[model samples]
Target: MNTTSHTVAVLGAGTMGSGIACVMARAGHRTLLFDVDETNLGRGLDTVRGFFDNGVRKGKIDAAQADSAVANLSGTTDLGDLAPADVVVEAIFEDLDLKKETFGRLDGIVSERTLFHTNTSTLSVTGIASGSRLPGRVVGTHYCNPAPLMKLVEVADGRHTEGWAHDATLEFLDTLGKTSVVTKDRPGFIVNRFLIPWENSCIDALESGVGTKESIDAAVRGALGHPMGPFRLLDIVGMDIHKQVAMRLYEQLREPRFFPPPMVERMVAAGDLGRKTGRGFYEYDDNRLFGS
Candidate 1:
């Protein structure tokens, strides 16, 4: 399908998924945002509106343009409605089996030429693609958190991904005003490959009692010029999610350093999931609170 002829359907209306849908809609694409839960679907639509409103208030986007962008977005709770999409992006949970199953269903619904991409952070794109009927059409389009704001888009060409499917995916990302990096089907691709190791190192320091949370955060910010320290960043990203990704990476690579640290596991077990849960490495009373 030509770019204009295709609609971008994003499955899951959470932070990342909603951000992606907003990006597409802002780019003037007819974007569909789908979620099974009513509350999530409503929140996702509200997120899109809030994003454009912020842009307009900041003079980044005119009110007319922002309204049009929102008009381009439609939310739904049904996956079957996504059959009309020329490109479907699965941006739901990080569970591999669930993602594989979703892709399999999407493969059956979408046309043979319709491209499929997953916003998976660490799962193997090849594994998901292999599980689908149209493996050749399945690729990875990993976006960072706050997809509407983040410019980096990693495009993964799985073992079977090639030709028009691959090219079209890259084009789609470019049209969304993102900088696209085409990566081979490899563990963690580019960003996570290096960033994950750094997170692991931070965990080691914490375990070794290198310093208190405050000291470590201050040191990283002051000495290394990092905007936020590793632990503080983990709080925002959610410790549970971070640990899950680390464990999966460690499992796939069998590298000891990639192992999820004990403290992270402890926190997850205690239900200190992070900002979403109001407690994590640090405590929050709403305003995205952080700690040392």
Candidate 2:
């Protein structure tokens, strides 16, 4: 992909997908955000608008800039429209098989030179590339949640991912105000290598009744100097996502430390999916929690 004037396509227009699309568009790149579901496509647009509105309200961006940013971004439910894109980044579900299928199809649709990126957190980039027609072109451009705001994009180089592709992806991410960290395509890579396990252990601590929710949160924030406690972070990350990513890491590494504790599974099963569901370790009052 030409790093200069490439049209970027972000598949799966969820929160992360939309945020990435917005950043690319704001950076003067033509962006197309696509999803198979119309509802999700619509929601993605709403999400982008809401985010820009917040920025405008906060005096971070002017209305004209927000309007132009929105104008540069377009969305669709069709994959055919993505054929002309120079780079296609899949920010869809965390499932390995789904990403593989999407990448395989993108390889056929886009030019062979187009860069394929997966915004996957834990899944194997090698496995995703294994299913692609051009394994060498597949690169991991894993972004944190709130993609437009997060400055780091973990650029993973799987065994099969081409060196050139990694360099190009790192450059692109850098252009979008992201700090790219290169690492081998290992489960959890670097950030999550330490983070996910820590969060999982915190859940175990809570499940084991180590302390009350408020006490745990206060200790971490006040004593540990953390911006947010593990449970609060999990609530923002969503309980279901935490459970799934934990399982993926545990299964890949076969390490018990990475295991999603029973508490998480039980909570997800109970439908208390953190902030989104208005409850998890703490209950949400109008999406804002009162007591921990």
Candidate 3:
């Protein structure tokens, strides 16, 4: 868990994984981004490149700095290629059994000292770690969506996670210029615990005809001073992902507020998966919300 001179491997080359890899590379780590599919790995690499390109355009980073950061990132389709990493962060789908199976497989490939971090917002860190051979080394480093821009990184300790692992994760996040908050291994950590329920309530409101999606979003933004309303946030989070998270939290806590509303499930079933799918509670075109 030395912050300096570490090789980091990020599994799953989706939005979160790509953003996490970009953050690590920008922080001067030699980062390897991996996905089972070559196309996904390619797309993840493209996302990292796009982030750097945008940084340069915005004057947040100079050309040389962006170039160096981009150079620090590499992609691989082979999980075996991750053995050289000092730390491995899994940013895959938010399925408990899938995460456990992934860690179980990695246990045979990675070194005993290689710290395992799961970027899960809802699943139990203890459950994921229990499948690992080095359970004490497994920690939760839940980065907010769009990891490169978001400053908060929630670090959680699993039931078997060692103190050093927790400390090291905080230190690592600090090196990446992220604010790390320590929380117990629980459903939704902290932000999602409050945020997801609120989102579900918003959906409920929409279904009950209390407000139009845009009107509700505007009301929350104007009245509550939230940058984005719950519906907009759900769109950003993806309807499918929101449903999964709500379902998991509901299953764990049995709270009605955590249950996904019927509209959410219907939208997900319709493949209107927010920005990624061009529609959700709202429609989108070329990543921009339609008409705004």
- Candidate of highest lDDT: 3
Comparing 2 and 3 on TM-score, the stronger one: 3
For each candidate in turn, the TM-score is 0.85, 0.87, 0.90
lDDT of 3 by residue, 17-56 (tens): 9889989999999999999888778877887887888788
Judging by lDDT, tell me the better candidate of 2 and 3.
3
Off by over 4 Å in 2: 1-5, 208-227, 281-292
| Local error of candidate 1 at residue 144 (angstroms) | 1.8
Judged by whole-model lDDT over C-alpha atoms, candidate 1 comes out at 0.81
Worst 10 residues of 1 by lDDT: 283-292
lDDT (10s digit) by residue, model 2, range 77-125: 8788898987888889888889888888877788988888888888888
Ranking by lDDT: 3, 1, 2
Order of models, best TM-score first: 3, 2, 1
Instruction: Put down candidate 1 lDDT per residue, 1-292, tens digits, no spaces.
Output: 4556358899998767887888889999889999988987887787788788878888898999999999999999888888888888888889889899888878777788888899888888988888788788998999876577668999988888878888888877777779999887777888887777888788779789998778888899999997777777777567777887888888888987778778888888899977657787677774222221
Per-candidate Cα lDDT values, in order, are 0.81, 0.80, 0.85
